[model samples]
Target chain A: MFLNETQEEVRNTTRNFVNAVIRPAAEALDREERFPSEIYEEMGKLGLFGIAVPEDLGGPGFDTLTYAVVMEELSRGYASIADQCGLVELISTLLVRHGTPEQQKMLPDVMSMKRKVAYCITEPEAGTDVSGIRTTAVKDGDGWVLNGGKIWIHNAPVADTGFVLARTDKEAGNRGMSIFIVDLHAKGVERGPKEHKMGQRASQVGALGFSEVRLGPNALLGEMNRGFHMMMSVLDKGRVGIAALAVGIGQAGLEAAVDYAGTRKQFGKQISEFQGVQWLLADMAKDIEAARLLVYSAAMKIDRGLDATRSCSMAKCFAGDMAVARTADAVQVFGGSGYIRGFEVERLYRDAKITQIYEGTNQIQRMIIARELLRKGATS
Target chain B: MKILVPVKRVVDYNVRVRVRPDGSGVDLNHVKMSMNPFDEIALEEAVRLREKGIATEIVAVSIGVPQAKDTLRTALAMGADRAILVKSGDDVSQDLEPLSVARILAKVVATEKPELVIAGKQAIDNDMNATGQMLAALLGWGQGTFASAVRIDEGSALVTREIDGGLQTIRLKLPAVVTTDLRLNEPRYVALPAIMKAKKKPLEELALADLGVDTRPHLTVVSATEPRQRQAGVKIQSVDELLSKLKNEAGVI
Candidate 1:
């Protein structure tokens, strides 16, 4: 009768753990520019890293909704954690579904947090349109020699492994694209300087370069010619992943504002006692709850393996925008204190900007929704 | 050394338990249950000891309905060696205050023969704070309650129990019971791998017949009700109003 009570419990547990353990460590990690190494280790130990991996593979064996719940809670602590999930699970799902058995076996280890991974599909030339990637993985003797480069990769430097998309054939255009799981530690592979990011400084994002880096035959992730579809295949799950992250950033902002409003006295009264501030707080709460429902709705659909492409797009776009707008409002709530770098609202405001840019871009999301609607003949 | 820490599943602390008005009992249907917060601390202590190679084989058990196995999974996820669930019927609610829970734990300790059994000083809901000492008494075992720190060396366990004023440490021989208070170390979250493996951990569910205890209702609640509501306070906007409310109206400036 209940809509999966077990699934709801999973989310609640994860949220509590993240709040108690992860949130405390979040601002420090961002302020110090240090990776949330302790959080990562703790998460790995707690199995946060492998939320969706099968139980047999050392994962919680959660459905997609459960995975979303875990992500929402983790991201609620910090958006950086959500970025890690997107790279590890959303894109990795493509590899899991279509990857070889050996590739599938590698998942449990990645989820174990014994190893780290990065995703590099965006390039200086290609951000929204992945087809323009110049990075090429050339076939060799039962292997491939990857050349060219990638920029804006999440976890580029520290990751031991990555899913790198590169062009395999110049003449074939879109069909020429291929996804490869390149070992970042391999020779000829180099990590660039960390990007001067606006937000989510806790996450290490930078460029990755390959100068004829050799990869094993097992490196090719899915069918060779179908790499474009492999990357495209509605990437709706990835959108949901980022949407949860956006909601997390927004939620953190909302909480910061509410907490500060309650404590900070203005003219001998708590700021929260003012009607104007209460209205702002109310709006913040409403936006966050709405975005949460949307993001979770998309994730729930993913768990059912239903067609949630449009819903995922809507959630991602809306959440990303909300993160930005609400974080700005949160800073307004904090007033002078929020402008500084160390304040979580400041970091949240800064970090909130990229969710809109990455993971196929908000503009691209609109296109996906439009295309789906047009195909359905629902739009005149 | 083998340690037996009894973990109890209570209504999750985060949830505000709702009591039906003029009802017979607390509404438990669809209630969110979790490992009791303090028992979680006890569980954490046992697991940490085992991980440090100070103890071998931490046995975790719970006494409740068959679904108490949920708490067992949590223990396993926290790295407890194994678990046993003593299943009691809905009549379990009828057990006089703490006697039924204490009795069931007593039976478990007799069978397991572990040197140490850790428990929570109180479940958040009942706050009865009686099960740990009672279980120890029924088993004729030495008892330690409100333990904040527990250290094991050689054959003895040194436990520090937190009191209202300060703390007191006691040295006890093997086969003692410890009930944790709120001041213990924060419990660690279950890792991904453990969550996966916990499903595979052996959980043997036993009915009242198996435990040789009668699961029958002996007590009944005449009414169940919500906490009394606080009277509404006057809204304050000005500084003077705020100060007046804090001092006179609220009486807590």
Candidate 2:
């Protein structure tokens, strides 16, 4: 209801594409656990990636709300596909904001999925804590040598390029970090085996190792010793994206549970006729809607240039928790069959699990929320 | 060649509509609205013709309340070069009769001077499958309704129409009318970037009086009612019992 005409139009087109192509293929993609390059090519043609990039930079140049809307719709079809879109959006946003004109040349290739990208930030020592990262990029003549490893990195198996964050100074704490544009296929870069995942398995997640990987002078993004701040600047949008994805997972589960309850019978009546089942559906619907509204409001806050830090954290925390709870309720509504594989609700329950863990755990989100509340007044 | 497509705003096909207690019409209060399914097919066909180089420009026009502009915008996003919205009424519940709609369209045709007109076979809301035929009659042009396939040759359109028994292929001269059926083609999803560009496309709005066409209702809807709920089927113990019931009760054997 808060969407404008163009936003609504974008949602309709994305929803239709998801219904026709993404949702039907989601089951096979999950079962096979392979990257669907063919689908990404079609989505690139449709300009589904880098939604907020400027029009001149070969993107749709939409606002944050529209991006959130696309994320929700795409995730509703398949979270793995939406995660790919989110990955592209972040990389493209980085390039648009920080990359030099020459480096920005990769925008079209990245957006089109011709050059797959990975945002390399998570590491073995730095899951929730960013300062503990051992990855370092040292000055070598006019260029820098990257020495680090990123674990559980999305698209590590198939990515053509990576935006790697490494420390440039050890003594400066957060100010010591710097981001670089690294060629993943270059020498001294090794890819670990693809890790089997609980959900969103279509996404190829693994480790990326870099040892003595030489970088050109133009590889440094934005400024020296500012990678942590740059990454933090994009964190709100990332949280919004993941929150929307969680909402989509919950929405898909609700739809499946509602459909199944209406058709499945018990005691000579539809299961939906039972008050207990009715309450389950009701709670699921309300929480999903509430989370959706929170996501939208957070997105709009960012779009309107407000202080959206607290709102973003709240949305991410609430949406992730809500998705986990609601999808479980959806499975409860389905009873024994929900536990079996191949059921959509079953997959959704698995898919909903990662939302609470990734994009900063729900624990970190609550900390940020509490921090903001304490820093400012409770009313603020 | 220029093709003109007339699209209607109807209740979304996904919505479960209900007749009002007053029985005047189906409830439109807070109802979801979208371009009619058949009209989407019609627009899609026109876009394809344009893409194939048979048509130079595609114009989408709608006759309804002001809110129908959304439908016309959808058409533009789907690939129409321009749009014209003729406001026929102020109330969303007021539906123009087929003849009135045809008259307004005829005026549009005379002014626009398009070489071809493609429209949906019927609107899902009212199912009055008479507008295209009436427009053809009013324009003194041949029409092909329920078109499953359309191929434009040198100076004529070869239309394969779906009939009760089989398909009938017919040829119509230039500036003909064709109404789309289900099997014509599925509409393409409007790419996100295209939707943004469509905002800059030309969309001209006109009052019904601007065309100087009489739009008095030719017919009124009587009391509307919902179809009865279907009865549940019984489970038979054996094939012999099913055969006996079919022979004795249903009498179809």
Which structure among the candidates has the greatest TM-score? Answer: 2
- Tens digit of lDDT per residue, candidate 2, span A1-380? 79999999899889989999999999899999999999999999999998988989888899999999999999999999999999999888888999999999999999899999999999999999999999999999999999989999999999999999999999999999999999999999999999999999899999999999999998999999999999999999999999999999999999999999999999999999999999999999999999999999999999999999999998999999999999999999999999998888889999999999998999999999999999996995
lDDT of each: 0.80, 0.94
Q: In lDDT terms, how accurate is model 1?
A: 0.80
Each predicted complex: what DockQ? Answer: 0.37, 0.81
* Candidate No. with top lDDT: 2
User: On residues A13-115, what C-alpha lDDT tens digit does candidate 1 reach at each position?
Assistant: 6777887877887788777666776667666656676566665555666766666667767777878876776677854567567778888777866765557
Residue pairs in clash, model 1 = A45-B191, A46-B190, A46-B191, A46-B192, A47-B191, A47-B192, A199-A350, A199-A351, A200-A351
TM-scores of the models, in the order given: 0.81, 0.97
Worst 10 residues of 2 chain A by lDDT: A52-61
Candidate 1 lDDT over B84-166, as tens digits, reads 88766565343335777787777877788898998888888777788888888888888888998998877788899898799
True contacts kept of each: 0.53, 0.80
